[model samples]
Target: MTASPPAHDPEPPARRRGRPPRTESAGTRDRILAAAREEFSARGYEKTSVRGIAKAAGVDSALVHHYFGTKEQVFEAAIEVAFAPALNAPEAVAEGSPDAVGERLTRFVLGIWENPTTRTPLLAIVRSAVNNDTAAAVFRRLVAAQLLRRIAAQLELPDAELRAELAAAQLVGCAMLRYVIKVEPLASADLEQIIARVAPVVQGHLTAP
Candidate 1:
């Protein structure tokens, strides 16, 4: 009888697409997130693609999808990192005496834009959000929905959420004009000068009777 054909080790399980070994998985996922941020930063939400992010990360496009699913999800994941500092706004508001809540919040928000390292990605996200509804939704969810809700909860004002949103709008508009649009004296003004001029207005919104 012919010798039975030797088993071929089941073809090594076909290597299972995008399934890095457990130890490698975290690194791989982090790489994809980093790539996603770069891509979204460069291309904006409308133009960025999963394939481009995958190429940047040196992985298959399937792997990006595997980690983050849809392009919007990837955009959301990417901006979450850039917006992380802003996420602390509520805590900053809550920690200070209510008398200076506005200054604390203003300083916190502007401080984020003042730093070159944090400013770049935020500028990208702001541009994306300004131009794209999907990106705007993500921005609102991360900033308005989260930060405003917490500030409102902390302040307990009759119009606390509204006040929080107004405060956010003030800072956001200032940031856009200064950082993203680079408009005139505001952009050129001293960081402390901007903080002093803007903080009282922000405080007024939050603590007005």
Candidate 2:
């Protein structure tokens, strides 16, 4: 029978070896994000390049550009992924009664930092921002614009923006101390107890007369 058609046409003539067909991988975007996080965390935004991220992710630099237009965009994506839980501050505050807003807000903020998955990337971002002006600017723009400003707008009180900032300061400072710096007592303190102490401060800032 013609040697069985030469076993499937000699394997299709060994397939021409030019460029491999580009088939999208399900995890490509996520892989890029993960690599971006690691790069930004290690080198800060200014030092982390698209090529660096692509190399880290084992893809071409073009792939990184394909997924994220610029280094700034990648940084923003990393921030969004890391702080997604805390981004719900508006909703957390909005869902609660005025008096309990602080508690809800505190719980929400701490809950994010308390989780191991979110905490690691966030710790890296904070550490990088502490010494990198570029990182700090990116952090400030994303947080102040998307989170603090929006939360402030929800308040009926005077100096709502200021209050929101103060509240953010309180939470951010606490997070820095507990999570980043790893200060004893505070770092290892009970989450509930910490919330009890911090919620009132946040509430005071949110509702000060």
Top candidate (TM-score): 1
Clash pairs detected, candidate 1: none
TM-scores of all predicted structures: 0.86, 0.82
List, residue by residue over 22-127, the lDDT tens digit for candidate 2: 3434366678789888887777677889879878877666666655777877888888897777788899999858999899999998898898877777876787
Local lDDT at 14 for model 1: 19
Candidate 1, residue 147: the lDDT equals: 77
Cα miss at 34, model 2 (Å)?
A: 1.5
Please identify model 1 stretches exceeding 4 Å from their true place.
1-23
lDDT of 2 at 39: 82
Model 1: how far is 153 from its true place, Å? Answer: 1.0
Model 2 poorest ten-residue lDDT run? 1-10
On the 0 to 100 scale, the lDDT of residue 87 in model 2 is: 80
